[model samples]
Target: MGVFKLPWSLLKDINKVMRNFWWGQVEEERKIHWVSWKTMGKLKTAGGMGFRESHSFNLAMLAKQGWKLLHHPQALASLVLKAKYFPHSEFFQAKLGSKPSFIWRSIMDARELVKRGTRWRVGNGEAIKIWEDKWVPKLPYAKIMSPVRVLSPEAFVSILIDPGTKQWKTSMVEDLFLPEEATLIKQIPISFNNSPDKLIWSGCMAPVLKETSKMFLPKPTIKNLIKELEDSGGKELVEEFAVVARRDAAVDRIQCKIGIGLIIRDWNGRVVATSRKFRPLFPDPLLAEAMGAIEASCFGLQLGIKRIILEGDSKIVISAINNREENWSAMGMLIEDVKIKLNSYEEWSASHVRREGNQAAHKLARDALLHSISSVDMGIISHCIHDCN
Candidate 1:
């Protein structure tokens, strides 16, 4: 399927074969499918095993091949394809002719997906056309918010930046864009360092890194989620003390530790008390995280903090607590225990944060590996506390 486009009939037959195998049936036998293939193909987070839908998967795979050909022009296969189909033109601008090979035609068909999923990251911005290219991050395809009738064929993104200060030329942007569009352009980061503009794949781009043109990208972490929320002006409302917990498991050593960190702030951004703690070793990281939440609850109670927001980097534990239902899994009992502790608080809520937001707790958890102590007072780690004036 990655090498060449499969016929619709062939894909259908393949899906049928897979469906039969899933239901424990032979080619000659028919059986009831307990679950629909559509349900089975849904992601695990959506309550189904993540199975590939054949048609979309095929298109995605082919689009990946097209992406490779465009990005890896120096590669042997890319070089060969370039010579054969696009000798006179670049990959992005390549045109279909009267007769092309089946493979080349299939590659062209997939190129549309690659085009839709990529945008240009402005840098020096010498090559990108103002109206023609996709560079606006918030808009679909990074396209201009409104059509520009007077844009010159050679007009570049560099025109929008001031040569003297390396900042956005606000007057020029105001002249070129609608009020809302101009506001969005101001939020985009510009570098005075004169780096070349880079192509960014939408699928692989992260808010932290801005853009990545790579074929394989890392999954978005909790850190990325937090950064995105912060960038979007969404984290401003969280003004109270939020307890963050991070857990670590040393599988080889059969040891686990949980670290707890607290941030108490007023609406004015004054920190009330910040502290870190390390709990004794537990059987597993999930247990450690659950225990950490219970420990944080106790810590808050002792402090006489009436309102608390419990945060942990462990999605499983946090989700279990938030679901407000009994979980019967291995950590279900522990999660239930944590829930009971949380309930003791006058006003409390449990949420998940990315490890980035919970770094203080993570550091404390890692530090626990060197100690044999079961628990320590917040007083001992007084140096870790920061009291804002």
Candidate 2:
């Protein structure tokens, strides 16, 4: 399927056979499907069985190859294709020349999928067309929704950038875009070095440095659980070896700055680890809380904790993670990352708590804004929290 596009009729027949097998159809007898193939093909976290539909899967695989061609233009395959099919133009501008080969046609057909998933990371912004390219990170399709009226439709993103300070031209942005759009555009971080614009995938972009080390600890027995409860004043005890992670976010709405605080405890309520990080330009508190959870998950991986009980102050974010629903909003990608991390553990659960129950994490979050520091030992945790056994 990656080499050539399969016919729709063939794909349809393939789906029919798979559906029949799943529904227990005999030689001549058929049973009710009960569920649609489309529903069954959705991700498991989205309440489906995680099946892949053949045609769309084929297109995705082909799109990946097309993506490689665009990013790796100097590769042997790309050079050969460009020399023959688009000698006078780049891949994006290439035409379906006379008698195109099956491979060329297959790749070209998948370009739309690649385009839909691509977004531009603004730098000097000189290379990006303000109205034509997807440079506005917060907007749908990463493009301005307002029609081309304030500025010329041919304007480049550089026109809105202040070269003197390498920051956004605030007054110009307000005059050019809607009030909300202007705010969002300013929140986007600008490169001070005048770097060129770069294309990026908007979906499934995980942290650049992913932790690959694995550490699995032995599960504690009932006797150990009882002993831990006794040592910790019988509060928040679990049935087995578990790590409780309390997370909170401190928000400075006026400055668009946020601090994420995380406290990880053993089943006995001993502070095993704590993390505090400072981030900039988070639009809302919910997003900050979600980001805090992502950091907490990473911290847990660093500490080699496999079983976790995640607690947070935001009910909305906790519910979203626990329910595992399909999120299509701006924070969708963050939520997906948290879910993926938790699913890797042997057992993990998320629950909501009131601010009062998460005060220690709240304090850490506030401190993160004032001081940028991290603690793997009890140094910071001991000072911030006194209930550790």
Candidate 3:
């Protein structure tokens, strides 16, 4: 309210209205009811005041909201945050006496409930949380201040490619998250060809130390050093790079949408997956085929399954996945439909299954033709025919 500069009359009236309407309501409410103990150190339990302290109660609510935000690591806001602060310690906290920014403090306070009564990491899983987890201390968050391990690793770097950016990066340790600088090629140009030393053998040499007046040589601990490189921006930048680099050698991926209305499935020998009515939207041959591929991929991602098999009777759609012919312009993004997402999942695979074996997926397509659904209904079926190689 005070941030703006308005005419004297306007400002005066605004302030007057705020004070009379808003302030009056707040003052009146404060007097009406109180949800707190009477400033006593005793528990509100054990026959003490049954009222809840509004201050702590509000703080607890804020804390819960913060937990939700942190829980969704894949969300846009979360992605922005992890990019900011990562390779983090046991947990993050908002300290007393030293106040963080308004937004920061709000997020911290929103998750304050976890700070009280409940302890961090009661379970076995090592969650990237805002509190130091005591259960699995040595995992990611534990700060033991111990000596670094000097050992060789099995998988050093995996070339990764990000379809979104069309860029490449390298991963230091596969199956585990690594920091950015650890993944960057800070050294002079080194070729990856000729089966360059088995990842961990960063050139077999006894540990050497050469320290000058201003420089201290690091006895590089790939593991610990990677942990310290947690700044989220650096982590994502390097991860994206790795994704792109790995993608270069990957098999071509194709995308298209598949509607369930085109195929029928039977549970106990009766139609199970088809929609109730005929859908007029899927009038064209190309659209019907494109939607099939889309439906196949969505199911794969949702089921948390490894691979998907998409089988289509449409030769054009099936050929696109099997690499039989060129894609027509009518197939705009049809080729890009079931692909790209496979880049992130190391275990995931997809193939063009035979139309007979892909009965379940085909059922979804058949159902799509029945109902006038505007939904982009998608499902996944592993391309079991990839092994046909």
Candidate 4:
């Protein structure tokens, strides 16, 4: 399959034998074939058991050989193929000459599939075409959506990058692309080392097929999930000394600080303790939310509370805190601290809530930003929240 494309007749015969065996149709005794082979070939997460189609799988394997040719141009097979088939151009740009080898034809047949499944990761961006290449991963097609106007058709992606800083030229990008596209482009992290641009597999390819399969399914909203948790004997659990720690962060633009508010409630929903803290502003709100979570955990520890149900309005921060995967973002250290802090407790959990659901902590955070009041007693905290609201 890697060296040559399988004939359609052979692929069909192979699939027929497999289907007959699966449906217990041996010796001409037919059985019910409940599902179509095409449907069965879909990924498991997409409502089908993951089964490989021989013909498509064969092409994918051939495409892998073509990919190898792209990355290993100096290999023996690559050298021979390049010199004979495409002496003047690369594999991707190579066309079918008067006569071509079977292996070359097989690989070329899968070129479009390979191209559709891959994108370019920008670095110096000199080799990447701004309009033609798939470089922006955040976009639907991984290509620029804005209509071409000021820039010529042949413009390279390097024109949008700053040479000295090795960072995106923000103003130039904003001017050239749509507002949303520009925002996404800026979010794509630039390498400080200024590495060369390289071709990469896009998420639509088989490499990420498993992870992305769940993306097609519908998800319950945070509010519904939180309400369901509370109704499903969470009251009984809370009464068993499971403290609810509600935390929020309010950004103070004038002072350039994040005002963190924490409210710990006991079994009866009465406040056990209250805390207010201030930290320097972070580039993203997720960082500020993560800091607030750390503070919540510390507040519980200081009071010697063992079990906790930490709640926050920031879904991203809550998700990050609960995720087992290693975070490598700008606020990765802060998220790591939050995870460590939460784990210190004998029993702990993080839950996301809508802003309206976390009114008390939100009020406290706003009060911390509006007034100079730092901390308040548990009794006074309720009144403060009401007054602020």
Candidate with maximal TM-score: 2
Query: What ranking of all candidate models by TM-score puts the best one first?
Result: 2, 4, 1, 3
RMSD of each: 18.7, 11.3, 23.8, 12.6
TM-score result, candidate 2: 0.59
Residue 37's lDDT in candidate 1? 94
lDDT per residue (tens digit) for residues 69-164 in model 3: 444557776665445544242124424224444554565544435433232221111232212222111233221122223322321222322224
Model 2 stretches with alpha carbons more than 4 Å out: 25-28, 149-151, 208-389
lDDT digits (tens) for residues 122-211 of candidate 4: 667888999889988658888997899798988999888888986688898889889878876775545444556778666521121223
TM-score of each: 0.53, 0.59, 0.24, 0.55
Question: All models: lDDT?
Answer: 0.62, 0.76, 0.33, 0.75
The clash count of every prediction, one per candidate, is 1, 0, 70, 0
Model 2 has an lDDT value of 0.76
Q: Return whichever of 3 and 4 wins on lDDT.
A: 4
Ten residues in sequence with the least summed lDDT for candidate 4: 209-218
Question: Using lDDT as the measure, which candidate wins?
Answer: 2
Per-residue C-alpha lDDT of model 1 across residues 1-389, encoded as one tens digit per residue:
78678899988888887788888756677678999999999999997878787887888999988888866789998998889888998878998666888888888888889889877766677868888888775676678856675667668998888878767888888887887677667645454346556666754321211133222111223345446667777655444423332332221134334444444444354444444555433235554566566666666667777656677787766666766433434344445556666666655666677877665566545444445333444323333322212
Candidate 1 lDDT at 44 equals: 99
Give the per-residue lDDT digits (tens) of candidate 2, residues 219-337: 32434655767888755445355779998988887767778888887766667777778866554776688778888887887778878888999877776675534444445456667
Model 3, runs deviating above 4 Å: 1-282, 324-328, 347-364, 373-389
